[model samples]
Target: MQTGYADHLNLLCDMGELISVLRDSDDIHMFLDQTVALVARHLKAQVCSIYLYDESAERLVLRATMGLRAEAVGVVSMAAGEGLVGRVFDSLQPLCTGECRIHPDYLYFSEAGEDQLLSFLAVPIHRGAVRIGVLVVQHEQADSFGDMDVRALRATASQLGSALENARLLLSLGGGAEGSAGLFQARTPSLSLVRGKAASPGCAMGPALILGMHRCDILRDEAEPERSGGMACFHAALDKTLAELNALQERFARRLPESASLIFTAHFMMLKDPSFRRRIEEKINLGLSPMAAVRAAAGHYIAIFASSSHAYIREKVSDIEDLACRLLRNLKPGEGKDAEGVKNGGIALAGELFPSDVLKLVSEDVTGIVLVSGGLTSHVAILCRSLQIPLVIVEESGVLRIPEGTPLLVDGAAGNLYVRPDDSIREPFVRTQAAWSAAESFTGTMSESTWSRDGGRVRLFANINLLSEVPLAIRSRAEGIGLYRSEFPFLIRSAFPTETEQYQVYRRLFAAMPDRVVTIRTLDAGGEKVLSHVDSAGESNPELGLRSIRFSLLHRDVFEAQIRAILRAAEGSVCPRIMFPMISSLDEFREARSIVYDCMTALEKEGISYHSAPQIGMMVELPAALELIEDFAEEADFFSIGTNDLVQYMLAVDRSNPRVAHYYQPWHPSVLRALARIGKAGRAAGVDVSVCGEMAHEPALIPFLLGVGIRTLSLDPQFMPAVQQQIQTMDLREAEEHARELLGMSSIASVASYIGVEKRA
Candidate 1:
């Protein structure tokens, strides 16, 4: 309506020209140059550079630079925490540093002539929580950019990400060797692959499906639920929900897995959790959709239960949240259907599916089905794999954009997926499967420590959670249980499990591991581990909020229960080592150890059977914890570095955050440096440092970790055989040399490229 406002609108529309130029470009290189030229002039910046994470190099490779030397492009790679660029990678937050050198975090790379320095701004280009690349601009003049500049840069960054993904896809389609950038790195695994029970079953064909899932935006920009005003309406919705409760539950039952169904009863109690009800009232008062209101309420419920610092409370809400996610995912599909062009023989892909959707497609004439969802243990995954369907969940974003049928392949054992695969790819899998079977047959009844030609050994272990998991773990022939998370069974139960009940469960677990050294982890809750009983206080960010040891300290009784239960389960046998979670401070670990001592003392007073001395440890998952490694290495008996949380906390990039998850590189130099530092510290202190994080499952990283002085590796049973086999063939001396070389590198991408193994056979 305003005259000058129209001109401003026109200036914005003029950006369409730059967008057109970017669209025409086929690779990330050309697009960056044009983007810098197009936006720098508008933003009043003298220099604009685009840095992308080189997956292989593990570094932020400068792809295109303006007002800099031509040789500088592609030659420079910054560590994830190198400079302003590195800090942006580390934090996943946009920054506008006025005096670049003055910033403590800044690491200057020298090549960009000093004249082009001063004010700096950078925004991460992310596909969900993963930061794929970064867009940065600097000017000779200080104080050059304000909020508007950052906003424009962010908007541009998003477009750049999409463009980069598209270009990579195009390259893949064109059969370019550079196309590997879009695919997850695969190793030419030399390890004897072990077989495990397929949990979520599904058969798929078309593309190896991976969903482009961003982190759930738990932090919505909407008003906080507690401040909303429509409670009476919420009550009415609650009443209506009750009227259809039976039918709703039946539908929900149809929508969830039987394992998940065990927690259905909690859905009822969840609707009753005072916190849950309060969230509903808050949302209803706000006049939001009852479902939206419910979800917001559930988010709050999940947040509290998730951070209860108590495993029992955390487990109590797992299924309830699952049911809610099922409900939410179901409702969302009906909102809009953005169907793309389906290839002649392409199949539909989705992540873990709602049971209703499963039934609908059970008999459909789909070329093949690819689920973007479904964990290995989920019913759908089991069913599909049993059917030998070419489905691949966790395939990154394969399911999202896997164009109809151009040809694809999935080698699940190796976690390799190929899109538009050559027809010949299948032949190798058939052969690999046979080789896997032979390896199994040859190694069956095998009882030998995994050892290399030079006599070096790599310990192989299994991950266990419940008594029900014993059979699976034992069947995997794992020598010992690497991680026994005591939260799952407790979470699924209706009420607090009694001490005897806990003993029975633990007894069953240990009984299965007669000769194995089982390392038991105390309840790891917080950020989704919602305990059903205790009310976990809400914090700004649950991931960084009260969790693990932080929660244990705040909830001493809960911690005592777990400690006593473990002692009781030991029943005087040499108990496995017990490790506390998220120990960032020495006092927290000390308090936890004191509490464990208190539990032991209580047992002693009762004259109950228990190990007189059991190994006690803490997870080095926090940076502050890393800072005190020498102190803890001396105090604690052993250390199990939770690489996932460690990397997340160290880098300040929550892997779950969708917007910046791409930037989460386990091999990032800073993370590697920290890992290497701890690995060395643990080795020097004679501490057994074993990693049970998802990264442990990556065979490529195993050697890297080991070379950094991590001899003990605890991983999932299925992956252990292959990793074990690889270790047997590897020269520890060489591996350590490679790791040392990588440690000296500047970027995670480069380290990954250099250290990550490939499957050539």
Candidate 2:
């Protein structure tokens, strides 16, 4: 039994080397030939053959062999369940027999020269649920294989699955065995161009800094170390990681959105969570070293979260990984890597970067990022945009194969990436880079208010995410603060911020825009903007479940605290408005408004100076609210069109889902009608109506919005110059006529076609 364990350890060590070889191998066919020969030698088997499933043909074709006739490698094939090898593939299980000739599923291939084999052992190779191929060995002597041999071959087959899958993907991308070297290692590789979504718009040229390659190493469940004080070492590291997270959060608090900076808050919460701690402690009790225990516990969560279909849940995988890395770094301080020294002024190439990793990479002064795989709505992309880092996300694996320090030019606006671009490509971007820099400075060219060519005026307000954005809004000459997402403070805190704590934040926002109207939206938590302390984690359909105003109402104590803070903060401010989000019914609106009034009355009774009658508003996000716009216009002081959710709910499409992202059309006739209806109703009722969603900043949609009588447009401060320019070029009368024409269109395609022609005209 002791010798069996020794043999297994030796087998694992040998297999690890083989896995490394497969990763670095340029020619997959050559690697397979070497794999067969080496496995035959290791197992002392006469025959070692590899059969790869041809997906298109639905047959298992012999790909490599060590002891069979070499010419029969590609010639021998069989359907699943047609032979011993086929039966293994069909069952997805290992098969071992002393006599294979008389087996029920046996079929002979004369060219293979395998008739002499009396003993057989075959194992299926797969990646996840995907069937890749089969691995088999045979001996002329009966009963030559045992359970140990079956386990050994099974382990080898498992390692081959991933390498074979990568090869298959490469072949599908036109990288055949002969062309693999040219595609990856040539002076000017033909397959070096990659197109992806432009998460942040800008140009950057630099070498590639590959990240996340050693991610699997973090998940390895190694045995206990031969050292005392393992538990003490782990506690020290955990404490140090917490301190680092807090420091980083505070350091970048002024530069990033509270939500973005507080990304580390999730790490802190995970550390404090009993389950995470318990899991680690349990592993340690079971004789794992503290370092190994931490990894094992983290790996459990990472695997579960990464397998989720929901993008939000999957994104948590990165957070957990970042935390694990931080803990590991603290455990072994000298092992810490300095990104600045290794790849400063380079573009980071990663599978996916968590938000914390984004901050780290940016601090190292990396020029930009190329994500070989990631979602569009990843917080990493958001951080890149906020930090003004150029970012492009591609679906290609070839980007990962680029040699370290290879120059890459990223055209983030066009979503184009050129590997090792020549001077011709660099010259245009270099010339434009200076101009782009100058353009972003925005030297007060536009006036405070935007007016069309025909002199119809529109009020352009800034949607402020944090107090840091105030200077930018003031610089852009925004008319007012149309929307201030009030959830940021709540999102970043481990516990809910107290009323006074909330007041201080609100006071800064109100003071920043002293003369302009500041519309503060109440806690819009849940949905995608989840609160860290909330109990909404297990909700299967969170988007449609308790969220937004529902979350605020369900926890009235929390809602009342926020409202009281807003009232207290509004003291001495010229115009402060409070808005409620996701109001589906009049009762929901009435109930929320009653809570605000209740808070105001409580402040009055307590002799606390407060803004008694700040303008109360409702966000027009739900389809039900759209239908009842007239009723809402009468009760609500203003209507802020939250078109992001409006379009999503109206079309029944999750905007973040790439599969249905195209279907989430704000230009849909139904959405246009809804916007028009709300605009007309607000006008009829003498109430202010503004659009504060992504549609507001989109220059092309400005005319349609203006013609629909949406006089107030709220958008990100960065878009002010372009939006001002677009408005200045438009004639309001022409815009009105265009809006009329658009309303008559029944389909999104027609609206698009009409707009295309109108632009040309």
Candidate 3:
């Protein structure tokens, strides 16, 4: 921001070219030497060094020094909280001393005989939250690192964070750092650097931690007169690296202990298989190092594989494709963003942030971001989704084709990113904008007793995980929470949350809606919500396997913790509705209700004031559950039709598997017949019935659901108003006639088409 500060940054950037070849180091000392020299040259410092956090020893070891003694390299180690470097490591914060001697927090570790120390700056190189180490810049002339120097160093430190995070994960994925812990950590946004379109509109800018230049010896064979002349030595080096990669892949495959994530295995299998390796060999025959050749070939083929293969391929190929892409990015030219621009007030746009770009995504001031290269469940995408940031992935054609910093639009709901739209293109979006505005306006006209106009009162409840969604729910004016998927906290947490931790989350969530009912589903452990740390049971088919009620039935302690917290969170005032998933029989309900009673008994024993009676419900998903619904109807308070699973099960289709996914029709007369049967069965016994499948938003299914005596619908909050409008327009007689006529139809498609006829018409 200052004239002098600008000069300092420019000087540092200018010095990047000098160390272009220093990246060939395999030794830590070499890396430290190159790093210090680069810093000293860039800052015009008389003294410069790097202090690394030796986590095992709990100290900062002076790795490389410019003006300090030679003996300080490995001998000088201090506690993480002991000295200047230690303080930075402990705090994970940068400190600048304009006058080193007068600085109160400054603690000197080395006995520099006669070196004058005037100014100083040190910053932590963090992958995400953990401070891996610190980078130090010093000068004999005092006050070298001013406010400007501090800012630049901090920015540089971020670059280090980004690079290391990317390098570790990518290398780990590529089969290099095989046994390292490559856990999923959410990217926190830097308050100082805002990402906008720099040279690209569609591309999202993550942390730009460019290592400036390659540090390792990536050999490039000179164009030889004959390919066979130096072939033996070349092949020997290639074989060794390939061996290294295989070992890496094996380690990775072993690290993935979760059941049935075949993609990870496929990645390792590919590395070991000859077909993929032969492609690299072919590239090497044309003179590339086997390492670079394998990476390049892998990128090309894997991209093709991901693009052409089955939906299962996408998930399975994630580890492989992600590894390939990261290696490609690192091998390519440039770092951070190629061009510069601003948006919502911050630096935006960076070169392709492949899945490996682990940027810090801080909570405040985060609005929108676009990733040119990622999928819906890529580590980055999943993390951002958990953080409630709008992100779009899987648009490779747009990444290269779109211009930099062009006005872009993203619809995270639909997984769509509109790049540089023509003026007329924006006109259609205005209608969507109007719909959003109208939805917002309903915040005042709504409360918990809300229902659709057709006298078919459907609860427009939100499915929430993170607290971030609370604001969106309030803004959307959701009547209550339908499915508070409890797995997200477990998904994001480092370990199984203590009761107190779970209670805190529950308390905050309940406090957010003091009057509204919140239905918190007990932790759905298996299938999609896998907890890596927990010792979950493996199943032949996880979706149908030991998941949901099955998981709860066996793992009682885990189940009890969630149930108790849900009741405790309900406290005295806000009515709480608790539900279980995959309930197959009345016995499971009896067992589940026992757990509920046990939870209540515990609370009563603790003498905490709470609801004596919380409404208990079960997801009527499995066929056995539907068949026995009549038996459990008297025991259960309400039945929220889990149509997502019901349609899949009844149709003999798997919703997640894309192949037969087309057969998953909610309109299928069979599905409607099942719904009518269940809804009517629940209604006859005086049990309230609600439908919560994706079909609740389907205009045609509404009439069928209403016709089935389904009194309540719990659709998404955004769809509630529109659904309500539809319900208010139709009478019970009309819906009954429509359902009776449609039920007689042969196909769900026809029923849907029949429902397509406007009720007003």
Q: Which is the leading candidate under lDDT?
A: 2
TM-scores for candidates 1 onward, in order: 0.50, 0.67, 0.53
Better of 1 and 3 by TM-score: 3
Cα error of candidate 3 at position 577, Å: 1.6
Report the C-alpha lDDT of model 3 over 1-761, residue by residue, as the tens digit.
12265566675574444333223422234334455655665666756666766655667776566555443455567787776777888898888876766766666542332134667778887877877778887765556666767777776666655554444454355455332332211122111211221111122222222221111112222232222323343345445434544554444234321111221334446556777667767776887754467456755765574454243343334455444433333333331123111223211222233222222222222344554333343445555555445665322211322343445555555555555545565666667667767876775565545544455455567767566577767766677777776765565433556666577677777888888878777777776565544544435566766778877779788788888777777886467888888788888888998998988898898997667788998788778877777887888987878899888888788765655777767777787778888987897899877777787778767777777678666665566666666776778767788788977988655665776742210
lDDT of 2 by residue, 287-311 (tens): 8777778788888998797666564
Show the lowest summed lDDT stretch of 10 residues, model 1: 187-196
Q: Which stretches of candidate 3 lie over 4 Å from their true place?
A: 1-367, 372-375, 386-388, 395-404, 411-419, 446-462, 470-479, 535-540, 757-761
Alpha carbon lDDT at 67, candidate 2: 69
Error of 2 at 188 (Å): 14
Q: How far off is model 1, as Cα RMSD?
A: 16.4
lDDT of 3: 0.59
Report, for every candidate in turn, its global Cα lDDT versus the true structure: 0.62, 0.78, 0.59
Question: Number of the top candidate by TM-score?
Answer: 2
Off by over 4 Å in 1: 1-447, 532-537, 756-761
| Per-prediction CA RMSD (Å) | 16.4, 13.7, 25.1
What is the full ranking by lDDT, best candidate first? 2, 1, 3
